[model samples]
Target: MPPHVLAATRALNWLELVTETMRTALEALAAAAPEWLIAHVDEEWFERYARRADDYRLPDGDTARTAFAVTVGRDGIALLQAL
Candidate 1:
């Protein structure tokens, strides 16, 4: 598959892995930090929350797992808002 397709696939997978409530929270996060999704065209660094071992708690007291994670060199970002 192509790079854009791969990124889209990985992003969908991340969204699918979470619950409805978590998905809403993650969407908000994604909207706030668009740069977190940017990566090199040839890079393959997306991973699930469990394997990444990153979790976070929202202000509403709900927990969110690591929906997706990626890094381009030293600028790494993780979406820890999908349970």
Candidate 2:
């Protein structure tokens, strides 16, 4: 296959993985903290996250990647605290 095709395939796979992971996380959250999920998470929030995940790209450099990871970590922590 051509390089562009290979790259597109990988990106699609990554998106699928992210989407599936988010779905699983949402399921677990709904099961474990239904009240919290209902209070904090809405359909719009899910749609926004899904859109962002679909558009997500890896950071270009190490510093950018680290910052991205840190931001994601902080978001996870905030969600946990909310729960």
Q: What C-alpha lDDT values do all the predictions have?
A: 0.35, 0.59
> What lDDT tens digits, residue by residue, belong to model 2 across residues 41-81?
65554543443343345455547645655554554565667
- Model 2: number of backbone collisions: 0
Prediction RMSDs, each to the true structure: 16.4, 6.1
Q: Which residues of candidate 2, in runs, are more than 4 Å off?
A: 46-83
lDDT of 1: 0.35
Deviation (Å) of 67 in candidate 1: 14
- lDDT at 3 for candidate 1? 100
* Lowest lDDT block of 10, candidate 2: 47-56
lDDT of 1 by residue, 30-76 (tens): 56764654332112332221132223321121122232221221122
Candidate with maximal lDDT: 2
